[model samples]
Every structure is written in structure tokens, then in C-alpha cells.
Target: MASPDTRTQLLDAAERLFAERGYRGTSVRAITDLAGANLAAVAYHFGSKAELLAAVARRVIEPINAAQCAGLDRLLARTPDPPVAELVAAFVGPMYDEMRAGDEGGARTSRLIVTILSDPAEEVRSWTGPAEDAVRDRYLEAFTRALPDLPPQELWFRIRGILAVTAVDRVEVHNRLAGLPPVAGEAAKQWAITFLAAAMSAPPTGT
Candidate 1:
């Protein structure tokens, strides 16, 4: 059996390289090389490259999902019917917190999310799986309760937009809009929450 430390190193290396090179683009030898383990270490610890990718997805996504669920739990405990802004905040605050962390882990996570969101490959997206769906359903259910007036489809659209804004656009904007004045951490986070809340609360235009 590979030592626990080797397993951790492989995970860390895989995450970084996967974020940079993408799942299909990264190779087992490259992962092991970065991790300082033999090429067989991935097979020993994770069985295959697909399994390693899944493990990396779980490593980054589970914590964010757990934090979002916990935030929603706290909100629902106090206010069974939260305002859209509060609901949006509860759902997205953990993500922004991670983005604002200013560390290697945070950057890796941000890149991983962007990679997952933008990668057209079905397999790349499938890594999140039922865990992602379960958390998403919980939030959508909460939003439905909060805004029964809106059509369920509309609410889903807004929720997806909220996620895209927070997960993908936020990072892309920073890189692409370097010429623009930087929004400070707290201010930028609040801007996202406020913008998303407004979008969620908007009356659907009869099309």
C-alpha cells in the first residue's frame, strides 16, 4: 500500500495540474512526477485517472457544498422564509469566502470550478455528480419556498445564472478586466450577492 503522505501528495499535485491542464490534458506520469511518487502510485491509491479526477472533485467541491448547506441551515433555523438576498447570501457566501482566501488552495479551487463549468466534455462535468445535484436541489427548493410567485423554471434559470456569475464570471472578470478598477474583496462579494438577489427577485417578463 502507498503511504498516506503519498496519497495526499498525489491529490494535491493532481488538483493543481488538473486545474492548469484540465482532466483530459493531464497525464498519470505528470501527476506522479509532480507528486514525487512513482507512476504506479495513482493506481495504488485511486485505481485510475478517472477515479483520481473524481477524488480531486470531491476534495474541493465537498467543503464548499458543506459550507453552503450549513449556511442555509442556519438561515432556515432563524427565518423559515428568507428574503432572496439572504438566501442568495447563504448559498454563495462560502464560495466568495473561498475566492477571497488568497491562498494556493483557494486558487486551485477557483480554477477547478471554472474548469468544471467551462469544460464541454461530459466526463469533466460529471465529476461533481450526485453531491453537486443534491446540494443544488436543496438550494432550489429553498428558493422555491422563498419565491412561490415566480415560475419554477424561471427560478431555476436565475439560480443557474447566480452560480455562473459566482463561479465562472467572477474569476474571468478579474483576469479580463484588469484595466478596470479592482473591486475590493468585501465590496466585490457584496456586489455579487446584491446583483444576484436582484436578478432572482426580478418579476418575470411575460414572453
Candidate 2:
């Protein structure tokens, strides 16, 4: 049996390399080499490379999802209906906190998450779908309550936009925006929350 420390080492190495090279681009040999473990270690701990990728994604995503859900729970307890801005913050804040912590593994994991979410590949989706879908459904319920007047199609569109913004913020792309002043750290998060809140609350245009 792999020790807990050995398992962590493998996961950390896999996350970093997967972030840098992508799931298809990375191989078991490289992951074990970086992890300083033998070839058997990956199979011993995670069963396969695909499993390792899922584990790495879960390591980061589960915690963030938990935090977001907890925040939402608290807000809902205090008031059954919270403002859209507060709802947006409850969803986006935990992720921004992780990015701001300057944890190298976290940043890499966030990048990997973006890649996995964007990829059209079925294998990756199968691994990530359950956890991602649960988190998404929870937030969708809250947003639906907050914007009861929004047409279902429009609400889904806004939700997708908010998710896209969250993913972009996680990758820290605000710095790369040409002709726009660089915004980093908390400023970027604040901007995203405010922008998304407005988008969510916008009066529906009949089209």
C-alpha cells in the first residue's frame, strides 16, 4: 500500500505536469519521474493515468466547491434571498482566495481545470462531470431564486458567462488584456463579481 505521503507526492507531481503539458500530452513515465516514484506508484495509488488526472482535479475542485457551498449556505440561512452581487461573491470568492494565495500547485491546478473544462474530449469529461455538475447545479438553484424573472434561456446564458469569467480569472488573464490597465489579485475578482452581478441582473431584452 502506498503511504499517505507517497500518494500526496504523486498527486502533486501529476497536477503540476498535467497543468504544464495537458492530460494527453503528459505520460506516466514523466509523472513518476517528477514524483520520484517508481512506475508502479501511479497504479498503486491512483490505478491509472486517467484516474490520476481525476484525482488531481478533485484535490483542488472539491475544496473550492465545499467552500463555495458553505458560503452559500450561510448566506441563505441569514436570508433566504440574497442579492445577486452577494450570490456572485459567494460563488467566486473562494476561487479568488486560492489564486491570491500564490500557491504554485493551486495555480497549476486552476490552469488544468480550465483546460479540462474547455476540452471536448469525452474521457476528461467523464472524470470531471459528477463533481462539476453538482457544484454547478447548486449555484444554478441559487441564481434561479435570485433572478426569478429571468427567462430560462437568458438565465442559462448569463450563468455560462459567469462561469467563463471565473475560469478566465482563475488563469489570471486580466494582465494579458491589451490596452486595458493590468488588474490583478483582489481587484480582478472584484471586477468580475461586479460585472457578472450586473449581467445577471440586467433587464431582459426581448429578442
List lDDT for all candidates, in order.
0.80, 0.78
Best by TM-score: 1
lDDT of 2 by residue, 121-197 (tens): 77775665576678778888888898888888888998889878877554555556567654456776788788988
The TM-score of candidate 2 is 0.86
Please give the distance, in angstroms, between residue 189's alpha carbon in candidate 2 and its true position after superposition. Answer: 1.6
Q: Which 10-residue span in candidate 2 carries the lowest summed lDDT? A: 99-108
Q: Write the per-residue lDDT of candidate 1 for residues 29-148, one digit (tens) a residue.
A: 999999999999999899988888889888777878888988888988998888888989988788867544434435556777788778787767677667678888988988998888
RMSD of 2: 2.8
The reply for model 2, stretches above 4 Å from the true place, is 1-4, 99-102, 129-132, 170-183
Candidate 1 similarity to native, TM-score: 0.87
